[model samples]
Target chain A: MPGMDMMDMSLMQACMDACAACEQACTVCSTQMMDCGPACMNCADMCNTMMRSMMRMQGMTPATMMAMLDATVAMCQYAMDKCMEHADHSEICRMCAQACKDCMDACAAMRESMMKMAS
Target chain B: MPGMDMMDMSLMQACMDACAACEQACTVCSTQMMDCGPACMNCADMCNTMMRSMMRMQGMTPATMMAMLDATVAMCQYAMDKCMEHADHSEICRMCAQACKDCMDACAAMRESMMKMAS
Candidate 1:
């Protein structure tokens, strides 16, 4: 609220929605116990954290938020890559990969907006 | 694995277990949709993230790990405080609060160990 005045609320909301969707997809995907299970689990957790941190913006600084965003993006990318390996055969994996990619893009857009606001 | 050679495995495992427990408790508490629902939700996400980050330690540096631990501890503390406000009346709140306390302590122990290793 104090330092977050410059942030675009709509962008943050979109990112949070994407994170929630990714978390759900990853949670379902991890239960399949595929090679991507661990990665999907990690991605689910990171997406949840990223979404919650945005909601609790009072507890965050730009630097910390950027660090979390970067971590979330990396986890999403890793999970997406793992899911893609089985996409040809596993419908669930293919859908999970799509969710991860959407989440990654949403986070990237949020990061770019934050950078723009800071500059 | 590379930079985490000096870390104590048992302590990390304990912390991760505690995080998982807290995440479950908070998830159940949030479903109650009481005054602590939002805080419980935030804490659940943070605990899940903390546990997953430990599982994926190769992605972590000391700095990022410390930052995450601090954030998680703060979130747990906040959730615990909120749950405590209803602890006298709600059995679920009492259990949720206890789980949050356990997670906070476990995370503190992990942080202390990491600090000692760094020093």
Candidate 2:
């Protein structure tokens, strides 16, 4: 788009994919209704929003993108932390935690790349 | 939560319910792969995020909530516009468009309430 010419398309694509995967995992994890369910639901929504905003870059500014990434990262971290509490006995929680970690790292990398491009 | 003690719970709950309903409608509409599919998908994600964030008010500041509501409103408006183009030919599009409009109105109301509370 207009303001996205300098963006790394590959990195953005990877981040979007990671967010989608995390959203799916968290959605499934939330159905367990465990202590992490609320956090998982929150993380799922944040990841879906992050992915859609990336896809709809025409509607986003760099500042708003950064803010969204920060929110997504925070949600993923909180969900991951909560999931890890049950990881010892639940395979789904373990997988969900991994997805959240992956999503968090991808969002961080996307944010860093955006900062680099702006600089 | 902490900063939301002065909030209108009934309004917030209504907005959240509207968001959830809009998300569900948009999700179903997007599977049709019509011209409005992308916008429907975007709206679905935004609505889901808006609902979940309302649920997780403990993690939000008034500023972030306002910003998010603005984004959600924009997305819903766009999706509604797109779906309206196909509304005459498609029952699903008509329903989806109605959902988007409802969501947009709900978010606008929520934003106005938040602003009033802040003032």
Candidate 3:
């Protein structure tokens, strides 16, 4: 078996942490009964996927990794936007926004590391 | 609402597609009763999460996006490896491996597009 790279390990750890946080946040945030509920629900699901994927990365190629990242970014982008719309009125929105941001950041870091390794 | 950039949209669409594909593949693969089953179950969860996140991107940021991507890559990497180990003995492993590959490829592409936009 090939040795695990330091950057990869760090990135995966961070990604997993963020996913767990985001899942909890989104789960709580979704119960708020706002328009953002659907978005939160969606974010929760995505975060879970992103986390598990990190946990088991043997199947990942550079291309697939990149594709999943793009999808995550897009979804996070949408969730944050939705949460912001109600931030002034809903605390859940504010929290959900934060989770989204965290998840997005983690995903990006992973991608950067992967690219670095590839190059 | 702020408009979505075309490149972002395209990336998001691809990401969502891959997540969905990966989720379906993983879910089916998990029932195969191989050691890969655990990995497949994990992958299924992650893929679902990835897909949902795309459905709600308003919550995302560049940083969190990166984090999620990293996590997804790791999980896919793991699933692929597990499935490959059983590929010679199980047809389900073969299909699961393909799904993981597709997901990994899609994720990598999405990341590339994002970087292109950022630069």
Per-model TM against the reference: 0.63, 0.65, 0.61
- Rank by DockQ, descending? 3, 2, 1
Model 2 ranges off by over 4 Å: A1-7, A17-41, A52-119
Indicate whether candidate 2 or candidate 3 has the larger TM-score. Answer: 2
Candidate 1 chain A: 10-residue stretch with minimal lDDT: A58-67
Tens digit of lDDT per residue, candidate 1, span A41-101? 8778788888877876653456557656776777788788889999999999999999999
Q: Which residue pairs of candidate 1 clash? A: none
> Candidate 1 docking: what grade?
incorrect
lDDT of 2 by residue, B2-115 (tens): 466888888899899999999999999989988788777777877888887898775455665776687777778888888899999999999999999998898899889988
Deviation in Å, model 3, residue B47 alpha carbon: 5.1
Which parts of model 3 are misplaced by more than 4 Å?
A: A1-6, B1-25, B31-39, B46-119
Q: Could you tell me which residue pairs clash in candidate 2?
A: none
Query: Per-residue CA lDDT of candidate 2, range A4-118, in tens?
Result: 6899989999999999999999999989988888778877878888887798765445665776787777778878888999999999999999999999999899999989888
Task: Give lDDT: candidate 2, residue A6.
Answer: 91
Chain A TM-score of model 2 versus the true structure?
0.97
